[model samples]
Target chain A: MRPEIVMLALAVGACTWAFRALPFRFDLTGLTPEGWLSRLLAATGPAAIAALCAVSVLPLVKGAAPPAPLGAGLGAVIGLWVWRRSVVLATLGGALAYGAVFAL
Target chain B: MGEARAQFAQGMVAGLPVVLGYFPIAFSFGVAASRAGFSAAETTAFSLIVYSGAAQFLAVALVAAGTPLLVAGFTLVAMGVRHLAYGPALMKHAGQGRTRRAWIWAFGLTDEVFGVALGDLARGRRFSEAFMAGLGLAAYLAWVSGSWAGALAGGGALAAYPAVEAGLGFMLPALFLALLLSILSRRQMPVILIAAGVTLGVTLAVSATAGILAGMLAGALTGALRRATA
Candidate 1:
């Protein structure tokens, strides 16, 4: 209901669209692995992702809450262990573990 | 036109795997958005508009945290900066390809779509805008529909199940961690580890916003400088 959500969505959308659509229209021959641009891309995805994961999870871990840690940690461990890197399984497993732990 | 249709069909078929892969993630995004207080319409609009899984997840989390709109917007865009290269990379791999309708189909160029298209090209498939369209559409529909389904299934519907809802609260972090693990490589390990450490430290010492920005900067700088030394 907040107007900010709409504006934020549209703003992000436009910027993302430009990211996806522009390279098709331009020549970026110099953007190679050896170049800083390549390393920047290479570094950015995982690093940002890792940072995001840590930032998001830190609060839960720091809270010392059993359900969250159990659900998130065990779920991720099991999900990764069982699904061989399936996001669905990990998320599902984590939620299940949390629920089961909370219930007990 | 028939050839285009055939190519499109081929693309649709190629996109089948992506459709399967996107559903769960999109569904998670939907559930997270719903739980984060987004209406089904707003959540669906996110997939319909922004379309990137990581960016959408970040957007939902940021919005939930009441992060300043500017910070959230910049973070979302920054997370997607890598995508700018996907297009160029795909084009490069697609030597002697079509570009006439790229403005349209390019919009569907999500990471998975790009991977499938690039793999096809690498395997000697000719580049075709029609194929890209087919691929993008199949994946896009799956994402939007998956989000809708998850949104409908989550939120108010789960009110009675506090335990389950608590578990689901961890879904965003769980998904992000899984994604992080999937992409973990020997080359990027240092960058990732340092980023995680820095993000935690700064966030604990200062603010989440400063922590994230600092983490990104530290991680990126580490990644860039390593190449110079090695």
Candidate 2:
């Protein structure tokens, strides 16, 4: 088996176990509502998600120009999501926009 | 119908939206993994084992970039760390003193599942283990099946219509954009903006994995400081 596969399995397994075993309530009880840790935890979800989205969309490959189709598609997705509040609508709109741009 | 069966049925009904949303995203992951040179088996394994949309996508990118296994593994963990909050928020509903059942249900606590379960709770439904299990199982099947179908179809589709392949590549980014917009709020604006900026800057300077970690830390610190002063 490949070393990377093993590492992936172990990492995922550890995370799953941690989710089940960790004492979240006990830990939170130690902090006030306005405490730094509480605030940090509160922010982690949005921050991590935004970071993931940015990295995913940004041009990462060296010397590879940003793909216009992707940018347009992402814009469509954001616009549709804000306008409609529907993930399905946004995804479909983005896909259509991307296909349109790709065909051009 | 038995109470457990009824709850399970309700769970499945509630999970339909999540299942629909996961299909295209999972399919896109399969296509991206294939394009990144992963074997069909490997792609399937990622969905079955990791069972995380963002983490799986990041894993493929990290592997394509030839990152070290250890670094890649840790990065995936960091990406999933937000799930830790879900457990606490969900414990009152899903945990409910059944340690074994809670652990099993925890395995399926993806972002969408957490949202649905929480929504169910907010509507004054009693937290039923059977309900959560049914919801999780349905979503899991959709994800795994979608990945398999995509991996099998990706090669043939790409060979036939390369333009379609290019457009398909945009699916992940589009999906993420939609999710980010869905969760965006005045309270989260500062964190999201800071994180996006930090991620972009660090990615330009260093590596994508480093950029994500740095962004998370920076955003968290900024949030903490803001809260302390308010």
Candidate 3:
């Protein structure tokens, strides 16, 4: 088995166990609108996601230019998601945009 | 039908929205994974075992970029830290008397399931263990099956039309962008910008894993500081 798979299994398994066994609790009733910890946790998702997007789309490899189709597809996805609020439509729209650009 | 069976049926009904939302996204993950050169089995393992939509997609990108497994795994753990809160909040409504079953069910507590469970609890509904289980099962099946179908289709599409392969490469970034845009808020703008800037700078200077980790830390810390002072 690949080391990555093994690591994935271990990490996921540990998280699963932690979910069941951890002593953390958030009292929603007591949660203030300005609770920093809760807000921090919420912020993590977007931050991580955006970071991932940057890594995926940005040209990390030396001398490699950014993929034009990807940029166009990302624009299509953002447009469709804003207009439709539907991930399905956005993804499909992006895929089609990418295909069109690549083919051209 | 037994009470459990009835509750299960109701749970499945409630999960319909999640099923609809998850299928296409999961399909996109499959296609993205395939384009990243993951085997079908690996893709399926991701769906079945990790079962985290964002983490799975991120893992694929990281792996494709040659990130170390431990670093990628840790990144996934960080991505999943938010789920830690879900189990406790849900234990009261869904796990009540069954400890072991609840523990097992907790493994399936994706954001969608947590949202549905929370909604039910808010409405003062008596959600049963069986109901939660049913909801999880339905969503799980949809995700796994959707991934399988997507992988098969992706393979066929790439084989039949090589030009489509380049198109598929864009799927992950586009999906991430959509998710980010959907959740963007005025307050989050700074965090997102910081994360993006850090990610771009670090990835160019260091490794992808380090860049992601640095970006997440920087963004989260900034958000926390802002919230603390506010």
Scored by lDDT, the top model is 1
TM-scores for chain A over all candidates: 0.69, 0.59, 0.64
Candidate 3 local lDDT, residue A5: 74
**Model 3 steric clash total:** 0
Each prediction's Cα lDDT score?
Answer: 0.78, 0.76, 0.74
Cα deviation at B130, candidate 1, in Å, is 1.8
Error of 3 at B131 (Å): 3.6
lDDT of 3 by residue, B1-230 (tens): 59989988888998888788678768868887887888777788788888877778888777887887777777787777656667667766654355446656666777677777788888997868788888888888888988887877765565667556655556666666766776688888988999889988997798778899999888887777774544
Query: What is the alpha-carbon lDDT of model 1 when measured against the actual structure?
Result: 0.78
Candidate 3, which CAPRI tier?
acceptable
Candidate 2 residue-wise lDDT, A29-77, digit = tens: 3457687777877787678778888887776233242467666787789
iRMS values in order, in angstroms?
3.0, 3.0, 3.6
List pairs with backbone clashes in candidate 3. Answer: none
TM-score of each: 0.82, 0.84, 0.75
Residue pairs of candidate 1 with colliding backbone atoms: none
The CAPRI classification for model 1 reads as medium
Worst 10 residues of 3 chain B by lDDT: B94-103
